[model samples]
Structure formats: C-alpha cells, structure tokens
Target: MRIVIALGGNAMTAPDGGARVEDQLAAIGAAAEPIADLVLAGHEVLLTHGNGPQVGNLLRKNELAATVVPPIPLDWCDASTQATIGVTILDALDDALGARGSDRRTTVLVSRTLVDRDDPGFAHPTKPIGRYLTRDEAEPLIDHGQEFVEIAGRGWRRVVASPEPRECLDAAAADTLLAAGYVVVCSGGGGIPTQRTADGRLEGVEAVIDKDLTAALVAGHIGADLLVIATDVATVIRGYQTPTQQPIGTLTAPAMRELAAREAFAAGSMGPKVEAITRFAERGGIGVITSLDRITDAVTGTAGTRVVPAG
Candidate 1:
C-alpha cells in the first residue's frame, strides 16, 4: 500500500527526554525500527513526524539567550526542528534498513505549506505546544502577547494559531523520491507555515499547522491508499480521561463527524487526529489511528481505530 505515516509529536522525544541531540537521536532510532520493517515489507512509505517538543525546546533556548543573541521568529524555529528531525530520521533509517541489507534510499525534504493569511486561527491560537507549563510559567509569555490555553486536568501550554494547510510545496520532491524507491521523510512540524504574496512569492508565516492535517494533505497529494497516524495512544477513545472513556474500534467518516460535533474528543488532543483522518476518509481512503508501536498492524486493519468512508 502507498502509505503516509504521521508520527506524533511526543513520540519524537519523551516528555522527560532532555534537550540533548543524542537523546533525540535515540528516540528517532526506536521509531525508525518499525517504519523500516514496513519499508522492507514492500510498502511504499512517506514519513512525516511531529516536532512540538523539539521546537518548543528551541523556543525556550531562544528565550533564554535573548540577551546574548536576537530571538528568531517562530517559523524559523519550525524550520530548524524540521531539518534536525529530518536528519535524525534519515540516520536512524540508515541503521534500521542497513541491518536488513536493504538498499532503499532515504531522504529528508524541508517542507513548507500554504495557509491563508486571514485564517481565524491566527486571531485565536489554540494549539498547545512545548512542555505543559504551569500558570506561573505561562503568565510571562501570556503577558508578552503569546496565547496559551489550560489543558483539561493537565497544565497550561503555549498555544499558537494552527492554520489549515492548503497545499504542500515540497510534496513534488517527496513524490519524486518515493517514486525512485526512497523512504522520504518530509513535512516535519506541520511544515513551516507559509503564505503566498500577490506576485506568487512565498513568505513564512508566524503559525503552526497541525501535523496530522498536513499528513492528510501529503497522503492526498501522493494518492496514498492509507493514512496512518501513530500517536501515543493505542486507539482513539471517546470521553477521554473520563469515567465513560471507551475505545472506538471501527468508524466511518459520517459517524466520526457526528461524534466530533458532539465533542467526543478533546479539541487539543484527539480532535486534530480525527479531523485529519475524517478528511482523508471523505476522500474514500482509509485512516487509522494507533500508537507508534502498533502502526504496522494498524496499517493492515488489525489494530487501532480505523476510519473509513460513509458505507
């Protein structure tokens, strides 16, 4: 199957994983193992991963060094994380695929996605980012014009405008590579958000696109048969974190839309996953949500919450 796997943000690095390159590399290596198995199994794979923690860590660094060096814009931080994570995925894949003596080429392409400059999300940034911050920790940022939302029973987290992704600029490169047998890792952190000028020139925007949404865009662009979102959870559940929490085994786009309308999933967490998958499912493609460990099975419809078309 032509598959586009969206690796969850937290999976890139553990919550407690320090801001060290070596540790990040180790995490990516673990992630690459299963992905490599899929590749060796003869499925054409296109990889996209989240870098929320990584980008937030970089933002914290920029903040800490503000006195010594100028702080860069948010989009620049996204680009840095993309390059870093891309290289790490490439190296890890090298180790994993090399072990099996597979000669498949792997490459990383820095991706940019187009979004509307007037997206309402910019006015009300609601995407949680970085480590969960306490009210005490978030106040300073909030005071300085950054927006944050308190996660349910969790903690405060910086939120940014998660604009809708309209198109992927680097998709052609990824597609060409995939066509040539490369397990292309591209579109990290929702693909550095960008906008087009009147002359059609592209400029970076100060926003983040949800990785799952961009994964949908990539899946559609590549005409993928399946969109696999490997998150930390084994399956998407309703009434998350509540007494009534229950796993959704099988779903169709219409059914999920009804649940989503009733707010069955947390807006900050599972909402984007379901929303992205719904879009793909509407396109008559299969969408599976599962943990990183169960990605292979999920792709084969053996595990995870699978979403399909409306009968």
Candidate 2:
C-alpha cells in the first residue's frame, strides 16, 4: 500500500518553543523509526511535515532585519522553512534507515500548492502566526495596523489568511517517486502557496495553506491507499477532558461530519484534521489519525480512529 503521512508542526519541533535546531533533529530523528519501519515492511511511503514554529521564528528574524534589509514576504518565509525542514527530515531518515540496513533512498521535492488569487481567506486574515507578545507589546503593533489576537492564556500574535489549496503543482512527483520505490518527503508548511497568471505562469502568494488539507490533496493525487495524519493525540475524543468525554473509533465519513456539525472538534485545533480525513474517507481512501508512536499499529487496525465507509 502507498501511504502519505502528514506530520504536524508541533509534532516535529520542540513542544516547549524556540524552534531550536538540535531539538528539531531529535524530534525528527525519533519519527524516522516509524517511517523506516513502513518502508521495511514493504509499503511505499511519502512524507509531508508542518513548520508553524519554524516559520514563526523566521518571520521574527525578518521583522528584526526589516530596517537593515527589505522585509521578506510571507511566501518567501514559507519557502525558507520548507528547505530548512526538508533537509532535517531527509537527514534524519537517512541516518535511521541506514542504521536499519535498508537500501531505500529518500528525496525532498519542494511542493507548490495552488490557491485562488481571490480566495475569501485573503479578505480575512484569521490564521495566527509568529511569536506571542504581552498586551503592552501587542498594543504597540496595532500602530502599524497589524492584527493581533489574545489566544487563551497565551499572549497575542499576528494573524494571516489561510486559503484553500486548489491544487498541488508537484502531485506528479509523488507518483514518480512511488513508482521508483523511493521514500519521498515533500510539502513543507502546506507547500509554498502559489497562483497562476492570465498567461498561465505560476507565482508565489502571501498566504499559507492548511497542512492537513494539502496533505489530503496530495494523498488523493498520488492515489494513496491510506492517509495517516500523525498528530499529537492517540485518538479523537468527543467532549475531551470532561466527565462525558468519549473516544471516537471506526466511523464513516458522514458520521464524522455530523459530529463536526455539532461542534465536536475545536476549529483551531482538531477541526481541520477531522475535516481533511473525512474528505479523504469519502473519496474511498482509508484515513487514520493517531500519534506517531502508534502509526504502525494504526495501519494494522489496532489503534487510532479508522475512518471507513458506513455501508
């Protein structure tokens, strides 16, 4: 089976913050065990990772250097992160796969996801990014007309648009790698958002695409049999952390969507993931949302929320 796994940003970076390179190495290296296991187990594997923390760090550097140098655009920051994080994943996979004595080769393809130039997302920059600041610091940012929001106990950060990804420019790359038996790693930060001109040329845009949604698009384009979203949780829990909390198991796409309509998942957190998987499930592909530790088990049907057809 061909499997496309989307590793969440927090899953690959230091959960504590700072986007430290050493910690990223450690975290990504830990992920290699499961990725290699899948390859060793004779399944074609492709990888896509998130870079929320890393990009936020880069944006900070861009802001500090604005006076000395031209400010970097959002698309360029996304590109910068894709290269940095792509190298890390490739390096970690190489070390781990080599230790296991497998001859599988790995490669990274910088993906460009297509988004509508007139997407409603551009009208509303609702997705937050970058470092958090205290109210005093945040209030000062408003002088420059930057949008800030106070998220729970966390301080305020700049928000940006999150547009829907209409297509993946490198969808064919995955198929080519799968046919050649290579473990392909691509699509960092939901890929560098791009748009087409009237003359049919591609150019970068100033927005980010939802990583989970982009992963689903790539999985569909590559004709993956399974889409495994390796998130921070073991399973989908309804009413989480309360008296009536419940673990979600096998269910059809429609059933899951119904739960979503009733607000079972938090929009900023688990909502995108569930919606992405539900779409994949409805398209006749198996979807699993589980921790990276249980990825192999999830494939074997022993763990995670296995989304299937109701009939």
Best prediction by TM-score: 2
Across 43-162, the per-residue lDDT of candidate 1 in tens digits comes to: 999999888778878878754565566656789988998998898899899999999998788998888999998889988877666667678766666665667788889988777788
Name the runs in model 1 displaced over 4 angstroms: 15-19, 124-159, 242-244
Encode model 2's per-residue lDDT on 54-152: one tens digit a residue: 887777775566446555777888888888888888888888889999778888888899998788988888887777877776664555456778888
The candidate scoring highest on lDDT is 1
Each prediction's RMSD over C-alphas, in Å, is: 3.3, 2.6
